[model samples]
Target chain A: MCTYATVHADMDGSAKGPGSEWFHVTAATVYFDHPVHAMAEHTLNIDLADAAKGPNGRVALELRADSARALIKAIQDALDSVPEELRV
Target chain B: MSEQLTARTIQITGANGDEIQAYLATPDETDEPGPRGAVLVIHHMPGYDRASKEIVRRFAELGYDAICPNLYWREAPGAAPDDAAAVARAQGGVPDERLLGDAAGAIAYLRALPTSNGKVGVIGYCSGGRQSVLVACNLDVDAAVDCYGAFVTGTPPEGSLRTNLVDQLPNLRAPLLGMFGKDDKYPSPEHVAELDDILTANGKPHDFHSYDDAGHAFFSVDRPSYRVAAANDGWAKIAAFYGEHLATTASTPTGA
Candidate 1:
């Protein structure tokens, strides 16, 4: 089934994208839906994109649901390890 | 039967007179000697990718001229299928009205073909499956096939903009052939039963089949969900249904 459920977030950052070039990333679109390449029936997909750069200017990830949750925890743990003054 | 066919990407006018890219396939003129019926193959939510194009070609191989419009063309023209799909999904998917317009345009293109026998059908997979039924309800198609499309009779998951077509069932103009996987949760057995009851109550012509061992997207050969037994049977059913509804008459010269 196509869930048709999506969430979006605006961001200011940089990431390496297509053609091995770095681009300013301004948005992230996330959804759990049928993956284009993942072998699973469904996966949590994330697109870190620069909409201004068009569709191809982005890094995409499709992870298993459990993997996505683990990633979230890892990210939180890493951020928590930083000194409070250095966090910003 | 000749296996020879021709296929290519072409341009067609879509919603609001916008020119969109489409893939078209047709049997060789010499192989099938008559005005042929046409089919509008709606791509799934994944956008117009290689698999969708393959389905279009499969219809042509089965003797029907087929076309699949690029529903994501407006957002990501010339972009990769996955990229276009991502863009379209983030943009809240295609609007119902716009999809209708694109479908109508594709139908018109098929009917206008010199070898057309004045019959057109629609078949869609996944999200496209629901759209196929929607198109049949709103358009003048001769036949419709819904392959495990959800939300046709059940509530969509929360936050989904999709709505059930209960109110529109009476307006369905074509005979429908629905194929489902018994294990599919979206069009669960209950949902399929509800749809069957509604169509039956409305005196609509429909035939539905559910495979016990199959689940959602059983027809997707490229995906892990693909179930060979179910897919094979489903294709046979489609062939028979279209034969009954969209079969052409005796041979006729182009432009006759």
Candidate 2:
């Protein structure tokens, strides 16, 4: 089923995308919906994009529900391991 | 019918008279003696990709001129299907008015074809299913098919702009054929029941079939959700439904 629900965020970051080039991504769109290429029926999809650079300037990920949750915890743990001043 | 058909991307005036790309398919001239009924195939939320175009070609092989307008053209023109879909999704999806206008334009384009029999129907999968029903309610289509579309009988979740189409039920202007999977939860069995009840109350003409042991996107061949048994039967039912309601000899009904 198409979740038809989306969660959006504004962020400032650079990510390697198409053509192995790096581009500044300004927005993140997250949703749990049907995967475009994943083998699973549904997955948690995330797209970090720069709208001004057009559709090609983006990175996409489709991870299973469990994997996505694990990723969240891993991200939190990595940040926690860093010193407060160095984290910034 | 022969498998010989031609399909190509063509520009058509769509929502707000914008020239948007669309895939149009027509059967070989030798297969049919004269004009044939047309079908406006609406692609799923996955965007207008190869799978949807294959469906359009299938309709042509089945003896109908079929066209699928790229609903995401205005969002990310010339972008890949997945890319365009992402842009459209981030933009809160296509507005209801824009879709309505696009469908209307596609219908007109089909009707104006020299070999058109002046009869047109609409069929859609996933989100397109709900949009198919929406067009039937607001346009002059002769037939409408909804394949496992959600948000038709139940409300969209909070924060989503899509609303239930129950109020628009009374405005339906064509015969509707709905196919659903009993195992699907979005348009669950309960939701299908509710839709049946409302269509009955509105005195609309409809035929609904729910397949057992299947779920949403059962017709999507590329996905693991594809159920061959259910999809085969659903296709047969769709062909017959269009034959009954969208045949050239079928009587035209007054539009709302």
Candidate 3:
């Protein structure tokens, strides 16, 4: 069944998408629901998209729940490892 | 029995008079000139993709003119199915009023076909399932088939765009046929029972079949949830139900 649960947020980033090309992503849509290509029935699906560039400017990910949580922590850890002055 | 059919993408007037994309399937013209009923096949939340188009073709094989409107067209016109679906999902999904207008438009398109018999039905899976029931309550369709649709009875999770249809079932205008998996929790057995009770109390006609050893999306061949026994039987049930309610008749569209 589709969970129909979504969390939308405005963001700024660049991610590689189809054709191995990279584009600036302006928003993120996150949800835990049935995956399009993931082997699992349900996963933590996220879409990083640039609405101005249309639907093609999207980088999608479908990770297992635990893996997604680990990724969140890893991102935080990577940022923490960098000095504040260098990050700025 | 599967038969020779032709499928194609076409543009039709959709909700708000928007020219939206749609997939249409029609069978080979037979020697006999008998009229036939038509069907509107609503694609699931995943958008209008191959699997849903196959179902549209299957309806043609079953001797009905069928069409599945691309609900994501406004968001991602000409984009791949998965990509379009992703865009629609991020945009908060299709609005209910738009969905109803699209359905009504599809029905009108089908009835205008030369072979139409003025009877039209609707069948939808998953999220489309709930939309199917919703349209039946608000439209004058001949029959409605809801396959494992969630939120028709159960409360949608808070913050979700979906909602239960308990308030609309009383206004259902057509005979309803529902297929479910015993293991589906969204519209679990309890939810199904509650829907049955409500429909019965409202004096609405309905038939529901729940299969054991099956869960959500049991008919989705591409998904792991597909159950051969359940899907096969469910298909048979749908054919019979449509045959009875959407039987061909010598009449014209009242546009109802």
Model 2 per-residue lDDT tens digits across residues B139-179: 98889999989999887978886888999999999989999
Q: lDDT by residue for model 1 over B53-144, one digit each (tens)?
A: 99999999899899999999999999999999999988889988899999999998998888788899999999999999999999989999
DockQ of 1: 0.81
Interface RMSD of each: 1.1, 0.8, 1.1
After superposition, candidate 3 runs with Cα above 4 Å error: A84-88, B249-256
Q: Give me the runs in candidate 1 sitting further than 4 Å from their true place.
A: B250-256
Give the TM-scores of the predictions, in the order they appear: 0.97, 0.97, 0.95
After superposition on all CA atoms, how large is the RMSD of candidate 2? 2.3
lDDT of 3: 0.89
Q: Which regions in candidate 2 have their CA more than 4 angstroms from the true location?
A: B250-256
- The residue-by-residue lDDT of candidate 2 on A26-48, one tens digit each, is 99999999898999988999999
Steric clash pairs (candidate 3): none
lDDT of 2 at A62: 96
- DockQ of each candidate, alpha-carbon based: 0.81, 0.81, 0.72
> Mind giving the per-residue lDDT tens digits that candidate 3 earns over A1-88?
7888899999887998879998988999999988887777679999999998888888999999999999999999999999878996
